[model samples]
Target: MDPSTLFAVAPTFPMDDVRIRDRSRETMLRSPLTWLPLLGAGAMGFALDAGVAGFVLLLGATVALVSRYWKKRRPAVDAASLRELIGESNAAQDQELKRIIGSLESKGLPQYSLCLGRFLFLKQKIEKDVHRGQHFAVFAQEVEKGVDGICAEVCREITGIRAREERLGEILTSRQPTQLERLESARRESHAAILHAYTSLYQVHAEILGLGSDPTERETVEDPGELPGQRLQEILGGLRDEADMIARTHARIRRTIEECPPAVEAPRPEVVC
Candidate 1:
């Protein structure tokens, strides 16, 4: 399977951190504006009491000192503080998050990405109660790397699903074909359901990455031709029992479904075949 088709969800470039406030360059532009106000106060001070001029001068000096100090000081941060800020989460899952973080830190990753300016963004997602029970590992890395890693894993699983589904369809066609009409109907239905489920997940994953609504055309989606009823479970069970393919697929699908918002309807086609 082409990895490109698999994660049409991810961005083409590494997503730089989201900027909640203006950049230093923007702040520099405001320097003239700041001076205008200072000049107004200076003029007003001259027109009024000399005391007012002294007060304005003092205020301007204080502002300059504070701004300089703020720009020069490095924000305090460390792994322990991060853990404390993340505070707590589901015991098992939280431990997993922390473990992953520890591993990344050992590999020389930062506890925060203030330079990128999304440290607060990531921190809120981790520390807030609203995001509890949801996966946060993606935020730990840059958007491109995180999504690419996830897509790679899911692409492998999808390759297996497509392979197994095709194999199952071929077996049914070579043997049963359409002789047992009732059985054939059932096989087609089951296979269709599987395809439908996969399609919804495919679209959902893409939607999460802010790709405009899933552009998957209904006619283009893979159809399962036919799959035996009793044998359907056998195929799924075999793919599952023989290895970790189905389990991984299930996990990936569940993760996407869980992350998507409620109003985002699953994109299932209404084909009877």
Candidate 2:
């Protein structure tokens, strides 16, 4: 919102490093027209040492001063080019974030809510920093942190969820028990795994946002019940596949075990007969 901030040129980070606001120094440097008049004035002042020489030198100085101020106050051609580059970069980042959200939706990932929230937060932070005309190093660091945080959080969620799903699947397959027992155990383990995944995700989310919170603590976001049915479906659909696969694999293993014949001790059994 500060106009001064918008117009101020940052020096710590070069314009090339800035996706926006970088005036091409090379182009500015290459403009020979800038020094041409001064050079001509100097030559004329030397050729004619009359009082006109002093007037010529003074006129040249005035021209130089005005040119400098004009360049500083208005956007130069090179500066406009740099601004375009910055606009492109910002647009690209925005599109990337949108793609991430869309992919999560289509994949029906269980942690969609958490993922979407992180993306939104990051997008907001990036836009704010850019608008505020913040220093380049500070802006870049914040953006980099957000990216790293997103990656870490997503990786943890995925790996943890997969591991828990596998363990539950193993339990169902290897252990022979009543249907009621199996169902109850499966439900309990699934719930634990789901809750654990959410907890871990929440912790990572908070850390990325530079907030502090216990991983075991519940989130303040709206309850699952309050979310739209379709949204919940997208979140839980992938989880359902995992549960189904585990159950099916367990059932197959159980059937194979039941059908296998046990080894017999022939001679020892004959004495009993």
Candidate 3:
């Protein structure tokens, strides 16, 4: 997979949408046109201020206008709040990835370890590239999301494989051959899934490494055989196929078990008198 193709398939986070909404709200708030109604109300109140009621109305309108103006102009407050939220979410995700990787490392899973090392290297490269310009930030985020997804899926499949192995071990001493076979099959499938994920991650890393930091440079570079968008679609299709295969395997196992007769324990011989 080309780095551009990987980027095209990267998952989108809600942060961009949130940022857009914040900017729109800020723009609307800062516009003088938005405050016109308040100004008109204040003017009307001031015009009628011949008694206590009028004075109170004018005071209230003045307070409201001032409060709104202060809030609209205080970009630091809004920006800080948004930044804090985003920072917290990012921190939580980072912590989760660390925890997952740590668990895998403790288990001495070499494949996961190798993938983690590669991911860390890729992450560093992404950060460095993102620093080159504001435009790269979006791409960096997308790639981060993609890599994060790969890590998560890898962890999940590995965990499933481990669980299945443990189950198989437990069932080994039992007479439930069907159950044992089902677990063994599931474990094999999980291993295959992990291999697929690893391949995808490696491909993505290679492509990302080839990416230029400059957006203009990226625009000039193109593959005539496959557009980035189409490649992404293919990647997604492959993932769906893998998922479908796993689901079908599980369903087949379930059907087989349902059709099989329950295992019966051998009766003990009668005791001697």
Candidate 4:
């Protein structure tokens, strides 16, 4: 995979009015100015010995008043500020992608580039779909996290491969028969671990692609079918399992390499008298 794929043009959709409304509502709901006054009104009604019915009426009035006040006083969601925040977030993600790709390139592991490329491609695709709905926006963030995890797993696999190669080189040069046998076993185990990681990554990639392919699937549903978010969680969960396996395999190989004794010189054969 070409590292340049990571720099694919981000979707340029302007935040729609619906999304803006959603954002404003979310912000307003979280602010003390929205809820604290309601609480205060309730307290005042109780302190004044208002009956339950009266208190309820007072609280209802307070809500209407609060709503009207908020409608006028709430600051508009500044488009420029939102764009800046998104730009900053995208910049950070880009930096991380570059860091991962740089490490892979430095380690001469270009073979894994395809995995990274597919990840970025799917990520951008999902972002475009997510822009269509406020409900889907959270999935965009989840997708980012999932891609980050897959990229990290790819890096770990590359590191493990490099380490395995070095360890094998040491064992081969040592010319110890026992170590040679152990080396073969380690190679098989490492290969299996790498395969497992790739399988997990491919599964995640396919699932993400599925999300982008079907509009129906992407819809927030209340029925029996799986939700996009739930599927995403499963994908991330698989990636986590693969990561754990890679870590364990790496540690095991390192231990094997370290524990293998240095080459012992063979004693000379004595001639019979």
The models' CA-based lDDT, in order, is: 0.37, 0.44, 0.54, 0.61
Query: Which pairs of residues have clashing backbones in candidate 2?
Result: 19-86
For candidate 3, write residues 1-273 as lDDT tens digits: 112111112232556656645755665566665576667766776677647777677667766776786677566555555445545555565555566566667777667656655554554454344334443343555555555565545544555455445545446656778777766676666667656655664554444444433445556665656544444434444543443444455455446545655545567899999
Poorest 10 consecutive residues of model 3 by lDDT?
Answer: 1-10
TM-score of 3: 0.49
Q: Which candidate gets the maximum lDDT versus the true structure?
A: 4
Off by over 4 Å in 4: 1-90, 93-96, 99-109, 112-132, 138-141, 184-195, 212-230, 264-273
**Model 1 per-residue lDDT tens digits across residues 88-142:** 3223323433444344344343421121123223323323422222233333233
Model 1 Cα displacement at 100 (Å)? 24
Task: Point out the higher-scoring one by lDDT: 3 or 4.
Answer: 4
lDDT of 4 by residue, 78-175 (tens): 44345444555555655665666666666676765555555445545544454454554555555445445544554555555555566666666675
Higher-lDDT candidate of 2 and 4 = 4
Give candidate 1 regions above 4 Å deviation: 1-5, 8-63, 72-152, 174-273
RMSD of each: 22.1, 17.1, 9.5, 12.2
In candidate 2, how many clashes are counted?
1
Clashes of each: 0, 1, 1, 1
Candidate order by decreasing TM-score? 4, 3, 2, 1
Among these predicted structures, which one has the highest TM-score? Answer: 4
